[model samples]
Target chain A: MLLYTIYLVAIVAEAMSGAIMGMRRGMDLFGICMIGTVTALGGGTVRDVLLGHYPLGWIAHPEYLLFTIGAAVVTAFVARYLHHLRAVFLLVDGLGLVAFCVIGCDIAMSAKMHPAIVVLAGMITGVFGGLLRDILCNQIPLVLQREVYATVALFTGSLYVGLLYFKVDSSVAQLASIGAGFLFRFLALHFEWRLPNFNGDRIRGFE
Target chain B: MLLYTIYLVAIVAEAMSGAIMGMRRGMDLFGICMIGTVTALGGGTVRDVLLGHYPLGWIAHPEYLLFTIGAAVVTAFVARYLHHLRAVFLLVDGLGLVAFCVIGCDIAMSAKMHPAIVVLAGMITGVFGGLLRDILCNQIPLVLQREVYATVALFTGSLYVGLLYFKVDSSVAQLASIGAGFLFRFLALHFEWRLPNFNGDRIRGFE
Candidate 1:
């Protein structure tokens, strides 16, 4: 039940974030709705595919699509009001990140994958949706460019795997992981922290 | 061997298209390569997923990635000379569409999918990459909006499925489908044919 709740909340947060991003970019109704649906469902779809879950979560449950559409419509109408609370948006998005990381690890562990692969899959699940969303919108993905974004997910996933190694309670381990992820992301944002880029001639070849 | 040849030609065409599109948009080398990879593999990825194949085609075969990168580099240098041949580009893209459509249907039929689903999947597999490329580049998808774009694939897929239903030889059916798709697209481009949209409010309360 707790996991289900977390998933629902994450979906809502993702939908809201997507709608806001699309509205900020002046996308029309169709574009906003499409973006919202993609953002809300993308991570879970990737996770499901990796885990070999067929039919897909959103395709199996049409309500998620309807909810995303609802969020888009609401955002379209209330964007001017929401624009004043950028901090609140950031906070909600941070919570979503933590929730997704926890759920990703949980799902991977349930699938009985290797701890290292689970950690990697969890990180991909937590960050790939946002990365795809930003790429589609032609914005730099925060998880790719910002400090401790994917790192936070990776850390959280590693912690979950460590606790599992010790035969710890799954819920407790998940909660601890989520807390750690949230804290890491919060601190990174507050401090404007970032990973150092390798500014070498090797990196310049691709440019 | 025929399928392999067609696939290679399609990849080359996609790579060239991506290089031209990227250069036109002033993207750097990495961006150009990324676009080329997406253009070459995007359709196949969607096809594989819809057919319930996991890990994706490119993920299963890393050589496709390497080949796309090589093609991107070659096209990047040659694009300067090729930029003026817009008509040639369209014709090449049309060929790619036909080839991909035939391959998509072949794969679907191999998977024993229903003929209707095979035809639909074939059309989707033929056009989805270009749709994604256009969407990512912030342009309206030509497949969605332009004259006889997706329609060409659809017609070809329908013909392939029809031929299969009539117990036609696989190679003959494939060739006919490719010819039909190419001819449809080419003629549409030459004559500026288009599907009619319901400008009048036939379906009320929708859009």
Candidate 2:
């Protein structure tokens, strides 16, 4: 029940994030709503698709769209004041990332996916919403380019799977993974942790 | 069978196009293969996922990966000589676009989707691959911005549906749609036709 509540909160946060990006880009109302919904639901949708699991989260629960759309519209009006809440926004977003990872792992595990794929699915759910958001915004995906954000997802998923393997109770595993993942992300943000990127600008002959 | 052959050729062409873009972006070998495969298969994968179709095209036909990966690797090696065949490349790409549209339509029609959605599926199959490729390349999707490319897919799909409604032979409809779609794309390219984009830079208050 708590995870479900976190999931709802996460979608709203992601939608607001998308709405802010769209407003910054000068997109129209429909584009803003579309981007917001995609950012909110895109990760789960992609994870489901990759695993051949379907009826998609939004399709089965249409009210999720209403939540995302409403959040986006509201954000469009109050964006100027949002900077005051930036810290709160970041914390909630990080929390959502861990929740998404845990939820994604549950789906893959239920489907009997390989452990590696289950973790991959978790990482996809945690980060792909923002990846899709960046793509629509016409920018490099921040997670792929640098940030240790994806590392947190990998760690969370792996930890959850490891705990389950060691016979930890499911609920305990979920809470433990989510807590650790959130802490990891928070520390990474505080410390400005980043992954190493190769010299992508160094145009050598393709090797 | 004709459509199947065209599908193979299309994937190869799309993969090569992706490889060239990745190479130009100074992406490494793994990046090149990943981009190439995504470009070649992303549209159909997205279509099936959206439609809630299971088992996905590439999952069922793992050999498709071989085709795309092989084409990408080959292109990386022979890319310098490719510009001389730009016209040929363009033709094949256009042809592939049409073929993809027809195949997408057939799948949706069989799934008993609405006529509008069927047409949409075709357009998605035709353009989303390139849209995704542009996303990974970190640029605005060209088709969404300016090209009449999506228009051709729409037209081809509508014509195919209409012809089938009037009891046209299946083969006749397929050939007719592909021919018209290819011609439309070719002319659009040659004449430099474009769609209008609103002033995205004119940042008014969100409306």
Candidate 3:
């Protein structure tokens, strides 16, 4: 139940981020709404589809769809005033990332998938929405480029799995995973840390 | 059985297109393989997931995945030579689009979804792989820009559904739909038919 609430908060934050990205790209309202909803829901949808879990979350619960659309609309109106609050938005987006990771981990754990698949599921659920957003905006995916983003999700999922392996209470595992993941993401952003790029040298080799 | 064979042909064509796009973007072999596989199979995957179908097609048949990857690798080496065969590729891609549309409509009809949704499923299965490829390549989606691509898919699906409704034999309906759709796509390409853009007038309203 608590996990569900956290999931809602996470989607809202993600939707806001998506709306901002769409607006920055000078997209119309329809485009803004599309990007926002996709960013908020695309990850979970991908995870569910990949896992063959039927009756996708948003499909089963239409309210979540409404909530994401509402978040997008609100962001469209308020984004200009909120430009100075980019840090605050980043903080919330970071929290959203952790929340999504934890929820995804819990779901994967319940499914009893292979450990590697479980961790991958969590990371994909945390990161793929941003990937979709960047793609729609015609930018290289931020997750694929800079920041310790995907790594934070990987760590969070690992921590959650480890806690469960040690017989920790579910709630405690969830809280700890979210807390640690959130802090890790915020620190990464503040420090401007990024993953190493492959530089595409091999393509040149073939050429 | 015929549909299955057509499906295979379609994926190979899409995979080649994806590989060419990846190569043009200077991506390495892995990236080429990734884009190719996604472009070939991504549409059907999206359609199946939305409909809550289990065991995605590529998952059920790993050989299909291998086929797309192989196509990508081959294209990476032979793309320049194949440029002269653009017409042949376009023809095959058109056939693939039609095959995918017919298959998608068949699946959705079997599931007894709403007619509108069945058409939508077909269009998505026909077009989304290209959308995925363009997004990953950081370009405007070809479907959303120029060409009668999605419209052809939509018409193919509608015709198939109509034929089925009129008690046409399934095999005949499928074949006719594929024929009509492929012809339409080829003619559209030859004529340079395109949808009108929204022109982003409303975006200026906010600015």
lDDT values, one for every candidate: 0.75, 0.87, 0.83
Best by lDDT: 2
At residue B28, candidate 1 shows an lDDT of 94
lDDT, candidate 2, equals 0.87
lDDT of 2 by residue, A110-206 (tens): 9876676688689889888988998889876666555677888989999999999999999999999999999999999999887533343343332
lDDT score, candidate 1, position A185 = 84
Which numbered prediction scores highest in DockQ against the true structure? 2
For every prediction, compared with the true complex, DockQ reads 0.07, 0.13, 0.13
Which whole-number lDDT from 0 to 100 does residue B43 have in model 1? 89
Chain A (alone) TM-scores for all candidate structures: 0.90, 0.97, 0.94
lDDT of 1 by residue, A33-111 (tens): 6577668778867887777766556645657777777886776666656656667667777777777777777677778
* TM-score of each candidate structure, all chains considered together: 0.59, 0.61, 0.61
Measure candidate 2: CA RMSD: 7.0
From the highest lDDT down, the ranking of the candidates is 2, 3, 1
Off by over 4 Å in 3: A26-28, A195-207, B1-45, B52-130, B136-138, B142-207
